[model samples]
Target: MKKAILYLVDEAGVIQGVQLSAELWKKAEKVVLPLLEEPESQELQREGPLKDFQTLMEYWDFTYPYSPRVRCPHCGASCEDWRTDEKHTFILNTANLGGLLVFHCTRCGTTIRHKHFKDHMSIEHTIPAKYKKS
Candidate 1:
């Protein structure tokens, strides 16, 4: 099925939204479905069937397929949409007994930090300023 992924962008133009394709969706299910079939997972589902992809995406970060391009936080450019290779740096810290996530905007040379990289994407990167304060 044709899927339109939605992206949230900053004024500088970085990716903030995610939509999955039928292929990606199926892939996600492949990973999650097996887990859901497990006795433990089935027990958890006693509350209800897991109904959304976001839950699987959040639970299966390492396996979730991500696109190569990111939005430029300074220029509002859809880096992947334009197929540009401008380097955006991602800092993942799983060392030194400290946890931090950092994203560097290549277009405007801005660095953003968050307690968690995934949180940074879901909360800071994808959210527009207009909606950030709210």
Candidate 2:
């Protein structure tokens, strides 16, 4: 049987998208990234799944197989779809913190943080983002 349905969850730790394997993700990267960065495609506004993919690509730095197994902690939702920048979703990029992948769970309002360790990865912390008072 297949190990797990690969998912690109949203900030809510909810399965927002599905990804079978790194190979498939790579294929998507090739098709999506160029369009977002290409000068000719500037007029095209990226929305829906494309925006989520773009955010993930930017956060992962085009790395493949970010996590062999992606499962939500709160809801235990497997990889489904990648949702981003919605009223209930937000992906915070923490590259400075050792390439941390910070996802805010809009459903439960939980912040899930994961760190990359070579071929494998693990959840490092799950906390709220520190905001500054201006």
Candidate 3:
């Protein structure tokens, strides 16, 4: 299995950052098989064949279809309230950053300055609006 870099972007044109791994990409058919069986997923297929994992993943990486929503660091709403229209970008660079990890939240406008995976997770998995002041 070759390593692959997965980039996740949310709606509002935010690039969450590239995820580096040595895993082969999963096929959309494989990923959506279970979903297609569900009533809600079936309804989605009526519009057309539900997007495959590759397409969905691509859209997530470069398009605005993905939403910038992370797990709520506090209440854990796991809903839209935790989502934001703000855009962010994540990239893998070795020259300046000198690391294989970096990410930010466009919704909250926070950046993970440290060059470490732990920092990225801290920022990515933070509670929604917890660090943001009204």
Candidate 4:
């Protein structure tokens, strides 16, 4: 019989993860998924700035549709979709009704601003306080 599950190990032979066969995964799905999902009580609270970012999009009045992409000029770190990026590179710092959105870059302590205008968008970034020359 073939191995039902493959144990992915590190160089030191410590099991780092598991790769399951389709048949075996089907059997374990019922038991494993809940363990991975967020707890009920935890889910009740706010999920973070991501929700606020989405709320601001609903109020967007820009000429072009909203784009989820964000970039940090200070550190050259970027996220295609700030909402779903697993790395959490850029964090939503502020979202307001006046068509202004601010993000704080985790990789570099930079503040990025996306200012939406009627015909175009303006991008601005401020270097971290530590990097600011006196």
In terms of TM-score, the best-performing candidate is 4
Q: What C-alpha lDDT does candidate 1 achieve relative to the native structure?
A: 0.40
Q: Write the per-residue lDDT of candidate 4 for residues 66-122, one digit (tens) a residue.
A: 888999888788889887888777777777767778887766668899998888889
**Best lDDT goes to which candidate?**
4
Tens-digit lDDT string for candidate 2 (65-127): 654233447544334333422232333433332445555444343556666655556785453
Global lDDT of model 4? 0.77
Compared with the true structure, what per-residue lDDT tens digits does model 3 show for residues 1-134?
A: 34466767989768877665534435444675676444221111111212232243343333234333443334332334221322212211111222222223332433333222323422334324556588
Candidate 1 per-residue lDDT over residues 6-114, each given as its tens digit: 5678798998666676677777877867865432211111111122223433454543343434454544644552223323233221111122333444334344443
Better of 1 and 2 by lDDT: 2
TM-score of model 1 (CA atoms):
0.26
Q: In order, what is each prediction's RMSD in angstroms?
A: 21.0, 18.9, 22.1, 11.9
lDDT per model, in order?
A: 0.40, 0.49, 0.34, 0.77
Candidate 1: misplaced stretches above 4 Å? Answer: 1-63, 81-101, 112-134
TM-score of 3: 0.18
Where is the poorest 10-residue window by lDDT in model 2? Answer: 37-46
TM-score on alpha carbons, each prediction: 0.26, 0.35, 0.18, 0.60
Lowest-scoring 10 consecutive residues by lDDT in candidate 4? 38-47
